[model samples]
Target: MSVTASQVHGAVQTLTQSSDTLFLLLGAIMVFLMHAGFAFLEVGTVRHKNQVNALVKILADFGISALAYFFIGYWVAYGANFFADAQTLSQGNGYELVKFFFLLTFAAAIPAIVSGGIAERARFYPVLIATFFTVGLVYPVFEGMIWNGNFGLQAWFESQFGYGFHDFAGSVVVHGVGGWIALVAVLFLGMRKGRIRAGKHTNFAPSNIPFLALGAWILCVGWFGFNVMSAQTLNGISGLVAMNSLMAMVGGIVAALIAGKNDPGFIHNGPLAGLVAVCAGSDLMHPIGALITGAIAGALFVYLFTYLQNRTKIDDVLGVWPLHGVCGAWGGVAAGIFGQTALGGLGGVSITVQLLGTITGIAVALIGALIVYGIIDKMSGLRLSEEDEFNGADLAIHKISSTSED
Candidate 1:
């Protein structure tokens, strides 16, 4: 007995959907693990006294960000709501749920990025409040505008430039938005106390290079899922995305090693710089294009990190702005350049569209963050008192250390 063609098609569709669901589930899990990388990266970079606070913040922020994204952010961005019965929610083989899980991890990254910049001196509750507002309201608005095309901005871009802004993954949406907001948070929160005075800078050498390297390695591994799994469907997956990400990662490592003159912190962060820069165009650029984009991003991170620390005295602990903000924005713009067919790419991009869209994204992110952070600042304040700050966040906020008491 031969099966009918319709029956065979139905079976294939179901199987395809199942594969997509599993693919997205894996992506969600991988991105979720990047939060651990975020925590450990901060744990290593900050003073030993503040180490435990770093761990606590990443975990706690994940929880709060989930609530915000589930209740409001997802709805605002994609008109997706988990309010239905389980059976109804289970439509599409529960793929929507898994997709939500995936996007939540991205939304959660905003606070994880901020956690670093505000590391030692932030007041815990106020930052949490800011996290809720940011993830709930600010992030979703721009996310909708870009990814979901909620505001007709994509159409406008296409009309004017012959192509819509194209961030295949989320260099601008996730990393750029997070980094820009982090910059505002760091600026508003002020520099860590005693870091600089009387035209002199004090160094807070990383407490654990191993932990930092571990964090970088974890993020590097997870980023494959972050970039490749962004396809969201098995049929959409591309080997090019994987190869481009790999090439960019190597480029970032080599550039950072050379530019940083063998600084361990810079060396570890180099791959992150590359990954961030390639996120927007990974599927479009040639391997060589990815390498160039990543090399440029790695060098940019090293230079800007030093400039922010010394020349400007910004005190962004993990240099989230350079790694995520600057490089992510560069990724947004680079996609237009490197993604073009003329550049040995898969084509279908416009630098004009990318530049405008990137500018719009970063602008909204910065403004929204400033407003939220400013309000939190004026209401209960954004920073710990000098006494609490000098005492270290682990003791002042949580009354605990990484190691046991005597």
Candidate 2:
């Protein structure tokens, strides 16, 4: 049982490799469960009549995103080296696999956002098709250009400004992408029944507040994985990332509670606001900075949700724009302000670059989504029939009722 020096060295390497792989896999699983949070959140936001429709949409999106990521999205988002030299296309599977899981979570998230936009009124098949084009084709192109190194926008930014853009998780890539897609889908689907009549509002409350609360809580839990796991490499910083995420969530909750003013929606969406806010710079900010960033996100979520609903008449079924889009932007910008290199010594980019990156990301995502949605709208007609919408997507599209006996 005498171990040679080389063998001992090999054993330690293998053990370390195994530990890293285990951590990565665990993070992936936790990220996947965020889909459950999305499903419940969408279901709770809409009327019960659309429950099965919402569930089926979430399941289909996840499945489609998985396949799409495996085939193309993975390579597109993180397969930079593969395309760098076409002759060496086969040399990047290790990196590609890691990127696939990371981007798959993002792809899943975009469709989840769309669910809220077209809730109760979309044709299931068409929505599924939109999800494929979006996650498989559109999102990866921009994301790849930013994070994948060789082909990413970061290189260009670095070359021009002497510093590259940084997004710890995917404030712009995941949440911003999802939010813009939701915006376009909402435009195509039009308003819900009785939403606007002669410039007046209608009464449309959440079907299940308890369900919404549960879904929000689950999302808060999964968000730790969503932000920290984005680091890709686990180390001491992982704990710090998790701490930032938790504190930001707390800040979001406190902000929401302070602004609640007898509004249940604010109370429900506060923690999510926090989570989304911290996503952009979870690894960069101090715990106190996270709190401030998250609190601002929560307050903004309340205000934005109200503005979109009342002024714009954009009936976001579950407030995706506020939760993901607005807070995501906040997170991205907060990175510039609170990104102290002393703590972790990461980002060297200036606040101006961060703002530019955030704005550019949002604009690109919105325009891309609008174009895609317009094309889809022209070809397939995005909305359900008026009759179908009235009856609910579940009954009209699936030929089943939520109240049906087993």
Candidate 3:
């Protein structure tokens, strides 16, 4: 059979497209597993009384976010915009599937942030409600605007600054958004029982340090996909992102150890700080730059975590604010600094653009989260009664313990 020139070109395009789609699917799967890692990490950090509650809330939040993202969030964030240069959605079955999976992973991540804030005593139903609004409405709108090249900050950045804000992955989009929401939730929920008395902080050590360690490891493993997959290019940029992420993780661990004086909390939280820190500019940074960024972030995590715990009466059960919020902001700014022209920019990008992106992302996340959490607190009541809290959320709400007994 004789093939026409047009026919031959069509076949080549189809093959290339198929290969890209497959790679994206695999990346999405790996990102999804990070949710499990988060659950284990959060459960490990809290007391045994809250173990079942933490695990259950993680599961419920993932489920709720998945649905919300699919039904509303995805469209708002990634749907084809009426006005944009790349005005049309990419054509292919794989494009639709990959887009859905990518956003779904992000949706699952936002609520996971809240898990740490309301840990020991929040009612399951109220937590779920908060998760729905965050994943369904708040997260999607910002993410959609930033990533989708439509009506929000990303578009504004491009028009005003002459270059777009770059977040290779979601250091700001996912972690920053989650962290702000967690902070707001913590503020509204108030401190855990015995956490604050007569304006003094109390000790609330982890019930199982081993669980925390394991969870942190899981997150480290999942982070490869989170960072590398965002490159959207399976070959060149993706490899760079993966390498940068690894270096950052190692650097973060080392920094934490040095700063913490061999403390377990420092070691466990270090990798996470590194991951969050490097995420903003993984695609644009070299291995050495990543190392510096990660190390700084790890040190920052140790300091912020300690400060919040000791100086303030805020009870962030798993230290989500430091791990995600503080580290995330630092990472975004570091991206601006270390992501220099000599590094790995497709072309030279100015530091100003990176800084603007970082600040804009932080402001949007903080304000949006505060508003949502405030409304929810007023309507559903963010915290449980003192009696219910003392009894444990698992027993108070589910009537079952981690052991599945009466």
Candidate 4:
């Protein structure tokens, strides 16, 4: 009537595998929902006329990115492809497949990040083409080098410095690279039509504050999965990551509330700024350290977003350059700072190594973006015609609108 000890062990092993697979699958779903967050964030930030286009772009770009990553990008990053039969692919209970799905969400984020910067003006098909190449070739190159240890760069870092370059999640690999590339795309596309009418730049505000808040909320909720699930298995899971992420999120909110002078848009986006910055060192940082990191990121986003709009004449609508690019890079370097023994962290990191890795990531991203956006700009072009810009991307590209009342 009782089970054997061997049977108990076998049951436990099966349970562990299922738990890991389910954990990853849940992580993938959470990250996937962050795309919805991406869509609504763009929708709420853009003019009402561009809302439909914003939604469409996020969904369409995800499809294109998945295809690219599945067929080519995954191979480039990990040297592992699903070229085998169903049974062979089914090995490891298809956990690898789900893991692919998890990472693909991150890959798809590059274009989603770019979408906010180029909203209401970029050409549809050309952007899709660029996304294909960026995800397939550009992103995977840097991803492989950092995460997969493909180029011996991590080894070199360890040899030269005391420890390897550690991102933990993907402050540099995902957010930083995506932000820089988005900046280049924005530069190539130029300001939206009449963005600088009468020798003065006009300030356009978000049309839907509620939607914007919702987007931020979804992203904030899902980010725990994005950060925690990076552990990818039950045994590797840590409550510290969850607590750090929570602290960082609120730190960003409070900082933005102060820096932005209680602006609703800034208040909503504050948490996201925090989340992006904490992604690198979440595993190692103390709660207060994460808070400080997030606070800095929030201030950075507000100041740099304003600077780009006013001083630089760059129409990066989302301020992705600050929120993701600058802060993500800071997160990389901050990991070294806060992850040091003297700072009450887990230790095994160096600022010098972090700086080198951060700088290298920036260099790769900038170069890759310039080449891709430059070629596309010169060839098929990156922006819509003047008429299309005036008419709005919803009507011009998607042939639809957000409201039926009109």
> Would you estimate the TM-scores of all the predictions?
0.98, 0.92, 0.92, 0.98
lDDT of 1 by residue, 196-261 (tens): 877788768999999999889989999998999999988899999999999999999999999999
Runs of candidate 2 exceeding 4 Å displacement: 80-99, 150-152, 341-347
Compared with the true structure, the alpha-carbon lDDT of candidate 4 equals 0.91
Q: Per-residue CA lDDT of candidate 2, range 243-327, in tens?
A: 9889888998888888877577688789888888788788778888888988999999888887777777687878887788878
In angstroms, the error of model 4 at 149 is: 0.4
lDDT by residue for model 4 (1-406), tens: 9999999999898888888999999999999999999999989999998999999999999999999999999999999999899999876668899999999999999999989988989999999999999999999998998899988998899888868888888999999999999989988988887778788878798999999999899999989889999999989999999999999899999999999999999999898999999999999999989999899989999988988888777899878888888989989998988887788789888899989999999998999999988998989898899998898998999888788864
By summed lDDT, the worst window of 10 consecutive residues in model 2 runs over 87-96
Top candidate, metric TM-score: 1
User: What lDDT is reached at residue 45 by model 4?
Assistant: 96
Model 1 gets an lDDT of 0.93
Model 4: worst 10 consecutive residues (lDDT sum): 397-406
By descending lDDT, how would the candidates be arranged?
1, 4, 3, 2
Winner by lDDT between candidate 4 and candidate 2: 4
Residue 254, candidate 4: alpha-carbon lDDT: 98
Candidate 3 CA-lDDT value = 0.80
* TM-score of candidate 4 versus the correct structure, residues matched by position: 0.98
Query: Candidate 2 lDDT (Cα, whole model)?
Result: 0.78
lDDT of each: 0.93, 0.78, 0.80, 0.91
Error of model 3, residue 183, in angstroms: 0.8
Best by lDDT: 1
